[model samples]
Target: MTLSNPADGRDDPYLWLEEIDGERAVAWVDAQNTRTDGFLVDESYQRDFDAVLKILDADDRIPFVGKSGDYLYNFWKDAEHPRGLWRRTTLESYRKDKPDWDVLLDIDALNKAEGISWAFAGAARSPDKTRALVSLSFNGTDAIEVREFDIATKSFVTDGFVIPKAKTQVSWVDDNTLLVGSAQTPDDSTEAGYTRTVKRWTRGTPLTAAETVFEVEKQDVAAWFGVNRRPGHEGLMFWRALDFTRSQIFVERKHGPHAGQRLQLELPEEISVGAEASDLLISPKQDWTVGDLTIPAGGLAVIDLASFLSGARDFDIVFKPTPERALQSWAETRHGIVLELLDNVRGRLSLLRRSEAGWRETPLPGLPDNATISAQNFGGEDDPKLGEDVLFTITGFTRPTTTALWNGRSAPEKLKSAPRNFDPEGIEVQQRHAVAEDGTKIPYFLIGKNLSMATAPRPTILYGYGGFEVSLTPSYMAIAGKLWLEHGHAYAIANIRGGGEFGPSWHLASRKNTKHVAHDDFAAVARDLANSGVTTATKLACHGGSNGGLLVGNMLTRYPNLFGAIWCSVPLLDMARYTKLLAGQSWIAEYGDPEIPDEWAYLQKFSPYHLAKAGQNYPPILITTNRTDDRVHPGHARKMVARLQELGCPAWFNETVAGGHSGAVDNSKQAQSQALGYAFLRRTIAK
Candidate 1:
């Protein structure tokens, strides 16, 4: 088959599908959905859906909370409350089996009262915590409408601050003041459809009266602003995100002739900034060399604010990355810094503090090995006593999540544990390595009921998301455990390049022109699974979403024979026109600019849309997306499926009217989507 270039995507047959809500395009989607349901929806599918929903709405599930002034905030969704309930509880009550929750807002009630589908995105609390700027998303998209809410009264303020929906960021500067990053006009947004301007909005004033404080180039990714009201580091901060991995930091001058003016920080664009009491935290995404001192990439360093502002290159290096170790995240507590480190893709917790001589680092013990540990709330910002207590969650492939708390003096205490959703008596989890085409040992986790493969290869699903420096860590897949693993099927996660599993170097190794390295790495894992007898090409399927959707899309076009089916959701398939679709322009730094001829030459090689050819025996695929997805336009999925069908391939497309880039707004929608994919996989490969 001779392949024809998209020629900048102008000459494409299914280009009409790009009209996301067009009458003809929607009619096509409805037809496709009906056709998909005609075959996939059955007793087994319903059973799978119910089982997944049960896990999602389980009463015994851990209620993760974020620490506020006097309460721990949690947004909960259950069978009864599909929209969710924004509630809070005291730490004392939260430690119990059934915490006494005070519901501040009921989303279902709000949606019913307003006659609209509103999803509670989050709430940004005021400095005093008596008020909040609540964000509500329409059908769970990234864009949100911000409205002021009086927490004490538990209602939206009658004449309070309200910002109409768009890709916006809101942070409380004081009880009556807010620092907002949003597009005042359509022209104020970047090509990626994100806020390019920052404004200071005060209470009792029209939004148009808000003062513009900061702005960035229209070609930049976005502009951001915030006020740090921490105990000692109270000031205004601004950031200009040049791209995914590069940003410029600026601070408002406080006590000089330049007071009230923004001063750009003398730091590398690749390094991130944060405040730690009177100290400044800097984590370099790339190696930083300053005045004969060098801070390695992925290392954490801190210096006192006074010295840093007064031109000091000396920094207290607390953490450094190694070949197998990387700093995942860190938090500031009243007395110390809590570090979440990843050692060979496994979670490790540590604490750093200033001692008599200098800084000291200590490993946090009593953690479950081989499990992923994430800090839920590092309390102590408000009260020094609460700082001694830190909340975290632990989970793995087979183990359900357990939310734990670590006191300053002792081992972490398990506060709540999620009920086991699936039987794991015979399940086993193994961390294995698959050598990539370049001889790089790619790490992967294999979970299954049978691992030896002494008898026959089992039905397997390999999942991967290899972009944006995002690390794929292990988690308890409750739905997969009940839907796939309980039936003796196998699941594998490939920690390929273009991910931060091994830190910045690992991700940068495959970014831009070398992005194909990630696809090659994923294919290597699939081939290894087949060769190792864990699974065969005839029974193995691949799954990925968003960027992962792009990952498996490549697997389908580049190595179609390596697997039996593909499950892609909310994908970016049309690379040539990606920059013009929703948030695709923001990813130019990672995937390279397709508009550039030289870059497109390499990008076209990996573009699944352009690579798809007729007369090829491509495996069956179920491509799903959402009409309301403000990020990664749904056009990618719609166009790909149309082209595939035209080429006589086994392609199925499902476009949900609601949801966003995630493709499911709530649990019911999530369950239906999962069941559809699982059913499709079972029909095409599991048998």
Candidate 2:
């Protein structure tokens, strides 16, 4: 794909850099890496790197776990175990400070024995939790190879179920059968490079002989299959049409007049479905008219699956969001359902149970204020028989994370807490609002010390991610606390539009044609900070990644006077060609297709790579990405850096050899990459 330059009717000269693994492209990357390393290998950068690495590799960090039968499993990586170790322990021992864990898999040892750098993707276990399908990836890419393993033997099952590396999905239907989706052939993948066919594979049979069960059009995003087994409900097979936003769901009938056949569900394409026992919970993203009843957007409703399957349209409204309160997530227990609500961007937990009258709500107590609360099913999301127990974590910008276990009748019991990585003695947090150009109120969080003294502006770094309906909430920042706050710098996070901070409306207000509204909201927050004497433009910097990188890219190109430095990581800079990049076609529903005439007219306005000109006074920029990132192509960062350097702008570039989209495979790599970023910020703005 070639991008047209409207001004001079020419093509981008740096387009050759898009050849990710070409000899010329690799040589260019190596040269850029050497230049960046030369500037960041000083004594100050080394000190910062060591400090961040120490905090990351600290053994006092909490080892969070997931319950499976009588064991609690966790994946851990430290100085000794760089790749990581998958281990498990008893619930009783897990509650203790130093639990005795049984190692199930050693990734470092496996890598050594196999002579490959295979990263752990994940594992899907059988119902009995004694066997699992372990997934391992090459260089941390999305494509992975799956092998069957027996927990009792602590070894892979020889000549057992195995799938070669491709974007694949698998679920255990029984000990002898599995519902699988994978690229059977080169032509069996969607345009987005995902599997378009699903099959049923039996034990002791060759994978090529697996029977094709379901398939979708290659133009669609992908297809997936799974088995849902609730406690009092019969097992159900689910097939999903994986479109970007609008899709269809079909369920296989186990025992009925249409047994062994798939039936399409009668529901709106914009609604989400969740099941627990006989209840079918629906959350609508847009207004839906069912029979004579209308369910508003952001509303929750429930219906009996038996009645629904029988063509019954009667439904009961379970919960409705007001202007300030919106449902975030829900999980099921033995006899009750837990609802997580976001009220004005703060989390609130509530319990719901069904009775003769209707579903009733019970208030949960002892939840800390000004912190984000995440609740999960006690065992796992797919636990067939979850009991009346839930696990939760509470965290804030200045407070470390604390994990707890909650029963229905009492306050949450504290299980473990993360040891403090930095001193929070004089830290303070405050919520402030900024009014956008369109008269919208944007909320943001500020963390710093001696805020009462406004005589002098402090060096500050502002962060934001304003797309994909992802909300940014308060969370502890250990590196920021130790490297910036302790040394007298302020940090701020903007809750801009295109985020689910308020509700579906908040995100819709800035999506598609109105994408510029999110950029305006972020700029408003920066101006608010400067006007309040929190910081000056000379001492202000901006940081973001992924969609957030797009956010900061716009700031540097359009409003460079507001920031002294810009750090963009794993960004999508060439908006004109984003849809043609890896996994980029699937996100067209979020970012409009630039191939269309109308969409390109609007998209070109924010295409940072195209907007960057030779005469603009752009801020100093540091673009970082990973060579193994299959999701967002690293060429976006490479091309942007090359364009800026040609324009005589101070630009630095770095790319790691592993870690995929995250740019970090382990604690040491994560710390080292972050240390380079922080060191650049200190030199450009804090000095």
Candidate 3:
């Protein structure tokens, strides 16, 4: 299975597959796809695809929306509109079951008119909400073109602001001015292919004439500029210097003694900032010493912007985390702030407001226990000067998502509810903790038919994404419910370390040199499941994607006998050369720099590509990726599968021609991919 380049004298073989779009590389991809389809695209797989597609393309799915002036805008995709449509409805109308929506832009129509495959990226509206800068991507790639559209006229503004295709960021400063983050020249990008400079572009001027207002080191991940248009805080510009978890925040003074000066906020690099009226809210990822006081990591603090600018070191603590609790997220509303807290991986919603005495907390209602609840500033959270309306969503393994709107004074009104795609009758969800190798109690959610301990073990799929501080919360899985659970299968979601389930410390516990802690934690969950008789090793499967892909890949190589099947999607397998591929360089803060000899020594131990050896029995694996994924290179999946095949191991690789890192452009495509994946798992673990 070893490959090497004799001409270059390098041991690593199959690097040619990294060519991506090269004719030879594409030919190789086609051959692999044909081979995989021969086995996976069977009659059962097609039936699953049809059933999943019906659920995905159903019109009953909830269309999430955000407030913009008098409208609640939403982007919708279904069987009829594959490319989707950016439409809006008045708040009053949106409150009704069948809202009268106004179609602002049709992506399919635009693609047809332009004779190109254009996916709607996003849109940023002007301060007055009369115009917007719409971003359109080709085949869902990161690179996009932004064009100005007049909201009132419902047409593209002729001779208006437009930026050509590139990985660009656009924020409207005013009706005629925009703050743009993009390449000034063809080479003006970071090693990770992100914009390193931001410019202020005005109407009726060429992009070259745009003034450079902010710039960062080319080695940094990216730089972005945004203007806070929250009432009294209008015209306040905030600039961020981003480099993975480390970042610097700067604010442009619009008033006071330092008017027109860009002042760097005195805060730790590992802190995230947000504006709450006239105050600056900070969430620190590391312990910060301010004057004589020490703010623990994962603590939320706030200081008046005026006082902070005037050399005040005193900060009011909004919320502090305990050993098992951490701040999940926070949003500012007109009357106060809403904090989403996770206590031992369970959700708790709280409201904070500035009182004459100090900051006060009030528990918000309407969320169920043992479920995941997420909240956002609904009507006034966007403006910070208007209303106190907030929108929140609640879901769990057995419960379908229910979105509601709350105004802090009344009971939250249900705005929409996702139709039951799968029957949950007799289904049960249990939260259990598995002791990790390091003695850390890892929390996981197990879902299946209600059964007693005397019942026999059932087929199961254990899922995990144990990196990037991403929390694995409870959510209804429609496809799993219909395709797997309905057929008497169980599902488990592992909330392992290197996740924000507990707090920053939980994530830091498994990052960098200790990255293997996450893999060990995942394996611990699998072992617990098997030992408890919920599922046995022979009937169990493992699934993950992106960083999670790396998780299951480790299981495939390091613990091949632990599971019957492995479903790795859009994975990073070639750790040795990951930094040199696509945006891999940006994640050195989390995964450690592979180029460093000391770091590579530890990384190589868990690197699936390097760890996979010949003459060793491995579990059935299905590795999937998208050809147009500009983030994680598809070559990682391609090379891993090819190497496994060379080792005489049974492996399947599916690379879609379109779609980005997500690997699906439309509902149909998404359903087909899921159908293929679930089918593989079923066939591999069949009794």
TM-scores of all predicted structures = 0.97, 0.96, 0.97
Q: Across residues 342-374, which tens digit of lDDT does each residue of candidate 3 receive?
A: 877788899899889999988886578778899
Off by over 4 Å in 3: 1-9, 184-187, 235-242, 381-386
What tens digits encode model 1's per-residue C-alpha lDDT throughout 361-462?
A: 898877777789987445555552225667888999888898877776766777888889999978888898999988999999999985754748989999
Model 1, runs deviating above 4 Å: 1-8, 253-261, 383-386
Candidate 1 positional error at 261, Å:
5.4
List, residue by residue over 97-117, the lDDT tens digit for candidate 2: 999999999999999999998
User: Where's the lowest-lDDT run of ten residues in candidate 1?
Assistant: 377-386
What number of backbone clashes does candidate 2 have, counting pairs of residues 3 or more apart or in separate chains? Answer: 0
Model 1 TM-score, all chains together: 0.97
Ranking by TM-score: 1, 3, 2
**Superposed Cα deviation of residue 541, candidate 3 (Å):** 0.9
